[model samples]
Target: MESKQTIEAVLQGKIALVTGGTKGIGKAIVKRLEQAGATVIVTARNQPNEPDATYSFIAADLSRAEEVNKVANAIHEQFGRIDILINNMGANTFPGGGFNTLTDEHWNQALQVNLLSSVRLDKALLPKMLEQKSGVIIHISSTSGQFPIWESTMAYSVAKSALNTYSKALATEVASKGVRVVTVSPGLNKTEAMTTFLEDYAQQAHITVEEMTSKLFERVGGVPIGRMAEPEETAELVYFLVSPAASYITGANLIIDGGNFPVVK
Candidate 1:
């Protein structure tokens, strides 16, 4: 294993931007990049409860086109160019109960947050990366994209699936120009938000939180690993993908689901 100092040296001069980086997997990714010696910039709708002086924070709801531009422009002005772009912002907050419960607004919101936000941000930032002829972009998607639970993940899945496709297409368009685009699909990370989600469902179902967790596993056809992933684990994968060690990789949709995605792709 490499020393932490050696790992940090891998990204000593890299500048990274992580969207929705104040919490959960996004927060973990920010920490990982910082540990790797990258100067990180974080953007989200709100500031974190405890702000760290290490990375610069910008407040913006990336679901909005204007907000996406604001973040892109601010990054450009401050950093000149970003070497690593992590599209880690996303949500599955729509009301459940399948298709009948989701309105046009829900579908639109899903698309904006999970798909178009990355698309617009890439359009704004890729110019500099192309000019330099080197950069990496990672789209943080979910395993639900290809294996959605209709009662809960209908719109969210649709948006992520589209995002996966967009990421692949973008990677193909830019591979010859020396920029790499990749999609990372994580399944059931044990983040704070996930804990709350399971708790809420447990309450509604009149079951223990553990039971609710098991129910979710069953719904997803079982996590063969028998547990949810830690956000840090996912972040490590992201780190590897953006580093030079993955130079030959592009246009790949890597799934980090602990063997939960069922069929081989």
Candidate 2:
């Protein structure tokens, strides 16, 4: 059983930085952290088009080292320090046909977007957290990191697997410094991007979207809960991990896969 008291405005006065926070899980995390009374700063390649957006937005392609430096400098000048860091900017937009179809460019792109971006940002921002002796860093990984769908996610999975290892090692190095590092591995999420991808794949396969979705479920060893996760659902777990309630949690790769992962960890 969980305690309701842990879900209050526990993040009040805290400053949080969420990379790729304009959409999907990143957007949900920004909202969740804000609702918990944290001052949130978001970064993405483009600023969102909504006129009523609230959080501070920084436009930078985190895959580039210069851009990562720019974001880090801006945050230091404006916010001084960050209480929570969510490294959630990642993608798997490469051409799919197993390892033979992937080129050096594709592999580099996947690694830059999924792994190096977070690594560089952490290098820039972690010093502040270390100085403060209290902070939380959450790396948004995927179940594919361990259970790869090679035909579709070879390079992406490889990068995420590296991220999982890095997160654990960083957590071990930083735990005594009062900075908790955690990796969150979420399974299939029903985001707009995922919906669009499914639609495209379905059209290409000459099948109904429902049929395509079911096929995906079957391919991934079936989500026992019978559905994909919502972005907000993953956000809720992130909220808890960054809160004081999770002080004892670090060096952990937590999986929220609806039982899609066949093996027990």
Candidate 3:
């Protein structure tokens, strides 16, 4: 069996950057990477309320090119290089009434947040990884990318689908250069945002939150494990992917959906 000390220090001396790292799945990833002894840097539009946060934080709106550049420059100046990049910032805040309910603005926002932000960030930070000839880039995607809930996640899923394709292509391009790129698509996670979403959705549907939660599970083809995933559970997979343990994994889109996906890939 691996010793605790060995596992804890698996990522020692590594530098990691996790976007949208203040909450939800992003926050969990930050904690997991830090526990593995990696120096972590986080970026978000606002500072987190957590008083005991020790990770370096940079405030920047990732959707904007100028802001992305600002963050990239700051990271380069401060850390010089990054060994792990987790593109975890994403959202699905839009009207939910099928395709006609979505406007151009909504589409653009979805694309910006779910797809282009990672693209721009990768462009900005990838050079250093290429220079060093080693790095790991993980695009935190969603199961909806492949199995979109047309009425609600149309725009978000579309963007994530594009992200999935982009991740694979980027992985192929960089694999020969000693850099590894992968995508992680997680199903429903029990994060604060998810809880709030369920509450609002339940109110809108005039149903109890528990009922709404079950409906969601059914909509996703029924999780065999019978529950939503904890953010920390997803974070552990990310930790492994970014560490030396997953050295041979690249160009793969790993799904953590508790057997919800209808078919095996």
Candidate 4:
């Protein structure tokens, strides 16, 4: 059976830019935004044909500040304005044996991809949003940021925690201007990142990836919902945060972890 819809086309007259919006959660958010009648611009290092009629595509390497500035300039030249920006492009490294085995390069790379990339993009687009005083900036964060699964992903977790902090600070700076900044931190999302993690766990456990994945979930505290969240489930949250229903909300990092995050309140 199909799941019931949780968000409607409340963004009917908006324009959105979703970075890393090719596949996985980014793709899901792009589709949902298009369905809601928002004209979305999906960006990636390599551009793919737009999937939604109301959607467009641009190519830029977000890790490079010059490319990010170019992307912002292009959007200004072409779209004139952006009402929402979803900073979702991210990458993680394979587990590096143990905590002490990690290196400075690893930390720097993680920081660039996970946190600074979003910051650079936000800096470029934020001015216009401030001018308009009516835009939403949603950052895709991770539960590991708060939970700190350091035995496995120290760099990634730390970088995301930094991103969460940036989101809060940026939100405070712009909230009074009518521009909202918020984050959605998801856990064990069944995307490419999760697939690679399972593969690595399989190697370490000397078991099949599927078996290792099952056991890994059990070790982390079984997902109370009994399954990894689908791309659509995460996308629905992105949709709401950008919609009017969540208008008064800003600077909050909403976690969707299938009960995986052990924090209380």
lDDT of 1 by residue, 41-74 (tens): 9998987877445899999999899998898888
Residue 184 Cα positional deviation in candidate 3, in Å, after optimal superposition = 0.4
lDDT of 1: 0.93
Q: Give the TM-score of candidate 4.
A: 0.92
Count clashing pairs, candidate 1.
0
Residue 51 error for model 3, in Å?
1.4
| Model 4 C-alpha lDDT versus the unseen true structure | 0.87
* Cα lDDT of model 3 by residue, 1-265, tens digit: 9999998999999999999999999999999999999999999999999899989999999999999999999999998999999999999887787989999999999999999999999999999999999999999999999999996789999999999999999999999999999999999999988898889889999999999999998888899998889999999999989988899999999999998999979
Relative to the true structure, candidate 1 reaches a TM of 0.97
lDDT of 2 by residue, 1-265 (tens): 5455555678989999999899999999999999898999999998787688889999999999999999999999999999999999999887677989999999999999999999999999999999999999999999989998887789999999999999999999999998999999999999877888788789888999999999999999899999899999999999999998899999999999888999988
What are the candidates' C-alpha RMSDs? 1.3, 1.9, 0.9, 3.2
lDDT of every model, 2 decimals: 0.93, 0.93, 0.95, 0.87
In candidate 3, position 169 carries an lDDT of 99
Q: Any runs in candidate 4 off by more than 4 Å, and if so which?
A: 1-8, 49-54
Residue pairs in collision within model 3: none
**Best prediction by TM-score:** 3
Per-candidate TM vs. native? 0.97, 0.96, 0.98, 0.92
